[model samples]
Target: MAARTAPAQPAPAQPAPIASAVRRDTADAARWPDVARLPAAQPVRTAIARHLVGRALHRLSLLEPDGAPAGATAGPVLTLHDPQAFYLRIARHGLTGFGESYMAGEWDSNDLPGALTVLAAHADTLVPAPLRRLRPLWAAARPGQDRNTPQGARRNIHRHYDLSNDLFAAFLDPTLTYSSALFTAFPARFDSLAQAQHRKIDRLLDLARVEEGTRLLEIGTGWGELALRAAARGATVTTVTLSAEQADLARNRIRAAGLADRVEVQLRDYREVRGRYDAVVSVEMIEAVGCEYWPDYFTALRRALAPGGRIALQAITMGHQQMLNTASTHTFISKYIFPGGLIPSRRAITEHADAAGLRTTADDGYAEHYAETLRLWRQRFTTNKDAVTALGFDPVFQRMWEFYLAYCEAGFRSRYLDVRQLLLTEGTRR
Candidate 1:
């Protein structure tokens, strides 16, 4: 997860043309757009919406309060405010419109996770059969500027991760982990978030076979937690990150932990890394590599491995067919939260790593753990709204972040998305 920054400081008065251009860029790049003034729906549109929502919920085994299962408590289900407009928007813009409608408060549910779980389970069947083929016309095109070129990567990363670190600290546990955490056996209390995060990092380290005197390279350094842990295991850790805030804080943390000599924190891109190591671990970093550059990213990791070295990767993934369907489309999460990021499929990883001469040694899925992790983060964030606002985030930004967290949580809960820890060795070595 990258940091999300608001305008750093107010600008001095500027020339009219220059001011206009700046405003255009900021507005065009915004993930939240104006929807409060959506056009009124026609009578025919309302009729179509009633039928569509009724049939869809029925198929999903969910019941609206208007039609709750007899004698059964009203379980989670969609509750529409402006039914006509909500349906019309989905009919027009497909998935993008569905998300925006949520932002606009056109519909709401007290049981968001449960409601979304149902929707996620029936994602492919949401649209009518006849209208499905028209999906190409409704899906948003991926923006060219969102590509992960060196220059573009810097801009996108800065937009989120270069924001105030204090803002992120407000919600995350003391470990400063921003990725999926491996929780203890299910049905546990929320107090175990930090412990779960440590367990997750340790598992990755073990998977990579990091041991005493090992040279370990970590591609994404999220505040240096992993680096610190590796150094404590007698491993020399070299960790790289594009976030200036993260690097500065991570270095301070390392030095404070008295492990600076064993850990090297660098402000560099993954493509620029050059050394070989006994173990390499990248956590949730592949999503940011962009689909187009996956080959190069994996190739770089392969080249950076010494003889018999193993690479451990923790990645967020989707089903292969879903990945194929969304590969060319833009999503609200990308627009607002993680620009240029795309969750890969396990199949995609297998194929790409094979092409890079890396053979998979192990693959483990922990999608349920991610759901628990997000649920905890969302709770912490919601409880600390004042702290977030103190960091200069507005109401809209807050809502966007909440939605992003809940959206991801639902994906995992429904088994529509997953997080995996993968171990890979050079094809010849294995």
Candidate 2:
């Protein structure tokens, strides 16, 4: 009998059409060698890609090792590569990856601001098809309650500004003020952030039309700089802050400057405050109130001001045409920095103010001033990194802070974010 031929080995199974499609969809996202080396039964590459593509593309490029890109895409373009190590570093680490990736010669882009502008403009394209299905589910699961109460307010302020006074002091000007950007009517020779801040205070005073012996109230009195300036100008000042630490520091500063009698700093929520003042000024605090509370905030501001009193509000406004949660800036800010912060469009703020019986007297944009301000802060922070670290901040915390500052600078530089100063008055005033 002839020897039987060995049974032919079974042919490998071909991937189904659906599986092939899924693989193609994920082919553009980066996958770590460690992840790739895992057993074939566990496929994390697809999950990673799904997560990445579902969000907005911040920046994407293919680059050589010498900080020169082979090719670059400015808008929401998908990144597809299997970088040996450096590019993978940025993929693994989020914002912190940016500085490291740039410094390591892993990537380069000639126009970061342009790239950001394109990313922001095309952010809506990043949403995955599947995320639409989960929207209703998420909405159903989300609590109907609003978390913008007084205690919640203080907690939110503490999360961001109260991290360490020393850290802020190192970067901020001599006054230690942190608020909206400073503006000059015509560019002047003032050469410092402190001077710029002084100019901002002067502008606010001028806009508010504060008279000698007039009563002034400041909401979110960061570092008490404005309050002190107002008091120095002979206006009686009352200021409030959510941070106990800030209130303490401001109070001490006020006492030291011999203006304790003219200026008062209180650790109190804006909503809980009472009494009427000649003018009301709020800077940088509106963002923390969240858009849901805008109506209430305006109501409270209205109540706190005497009839005919002027109100000046300075804020960083989201662009008029931008959509919420597409780029999802609030998510990042809430998680790592200002937990309850929400920047609204100028239209939103003005509408709420109008609804609350306040008439807008003036609306001005200081978008460029913010870029200069942030640049100054970044320089100061970078120059004082050792002092910042000496204050007991860990590397992760430092990276987070640096990323926050630098990204803010980039955003302002790109006009993806804007700063606005609005002067308002009760119906009786104008």
Candidate 3:
């Protein structure tokens, strides 16, 4: 059996220097990957890019077809097949160029995830301090189409979750839990992933005080795993999802599990929820709610929650200043993936809950577990590459998914991202 939930403790520490100064809603890194076509590399951006690869990132090496750069350091080698083009992509597109170049096979890393962890670790420092001051000058503005309006929300969600459930199946464990799994130990055994996912759900249920006859409302029904577990525990569940694909599959899963009578999966937005539930549980769904709508998200929970009801939120979080600094500026994620999403800081979440009249009773975190989860996912994705392509994803799309997995793994492993299980109680704390 996996380890039981530990006692609640102080919130996760504000992460080390906001070097990446990026937003993560699985604290940003937690969101499913999304990609878009990008621009070509530029001369100035390439030079700046070279300096970072050569000097800044740790345990990284840049290898050119001709030879290593003069005065290059020793570390994980990033072998470049086309030197001029490779650096130009990064130079022109910055992070996007680097990823797109990788997708195009312009470069290869001896260890993809490890190479990314180097970038994730010292993300902010690579940008000269002076440029950080000029962030407003360059940060891409969030597009209106990506806003989390009811219609826009569904569109953004569809961009990622609706891509193909079969593709997700290639990598996800049997239970098909997409979010983080709370494991018993570090470097978790692959076979144990499903149980660890259960542990995570059970822990969230426990936090919300879910039990027999409890009216449980789930904001995001991710393939119905949590709803199934809750129904088995005798709690009646009303689960909602914006993705038609997810809602359809979740309903099928719920029926097959013989728990359909106990659970109802709705194709609906969290904002449109009705009725007061005994417990409110949303796992990493808050990130998709968008920072501008955070107050609305929390308020929805408060409204749906019955008197004395409890709440459990499994969220991915990042440092507060990083959240604020990057909130409005579009990054690689905002531009290509999860258009409307933004990860909140631990403080941001609690404060929002407080505003909604909920009191935080517990806050606990396990970042490394997410790292391990991503590692296993990357392994599975790599193993299933052919299966994924059979599902009709092309080479570039496959590379996009691969890079997405390694990128997230690196983020969590570097502690640049985190997942937290928070418990909240209504008035009187009963």
Q: What is candidate 1's CA lDDT for residue 174?
A: 96
Alpha-carbon TM-score of each model against the true structure: 0.87, 0.74, 0.87
lDDT of 3 by residue, 1-430 (tens): 2233434332222111101111211122123232223344466767876776656543234343244463364444565655666667666556766776666556666667766777788877877888778767755677878899999999999999999999889999988899999877555643388998998999899888899999999999989999999999999999999999999999999999999999999999999999999999999998888998999998999999898889999999998988988798776676656779998999899889888888888888788778778878777887777798799876666666777877877787777888888888874233
Q: Best lDDT goes to which candidate?
A: 1
User: Higher-lDDT candidate among 1 and 2?
Assistant: 1
**lDDT of model 3, residue 62:** 38
Residue 321 CA displacement from its true place in model 1, Å: 0.7
lDDT, candidate 2, 1-430, per-residue tens:
1111222222112111100111212222242222212123223433553346333343233222234354444322222332333234433433333334332333333433334445544544544567544434322221223256776777778877888889899889898878644644222224567877887777888778776997999988888889998998899998988888888899999999999999988888888889999899898788888766788899989998887789988888876656254223324445567776677888778788889989887877766577667656766776787798799874445545654665575566556787877898886234
Off-target runs (Cα >4 Å) in candidate 3 are: 1-41, 57-75, 427-430
Ten residues in sequence with the least summed lDDT for candidate 1: 15-24
Alpha-carbon deviation at 379 in model 2, angstroms: 1.0
Task: Estimate every model's Cα lDDT from 0 to 1.
Answer: 0.78, 0.63, 0.77
In candidate 1 the C-alpha lDDT for residue 281 amounts to 96
Lowest-scoring 10 consecutive residues by lDDT in candidate 3? 15-24
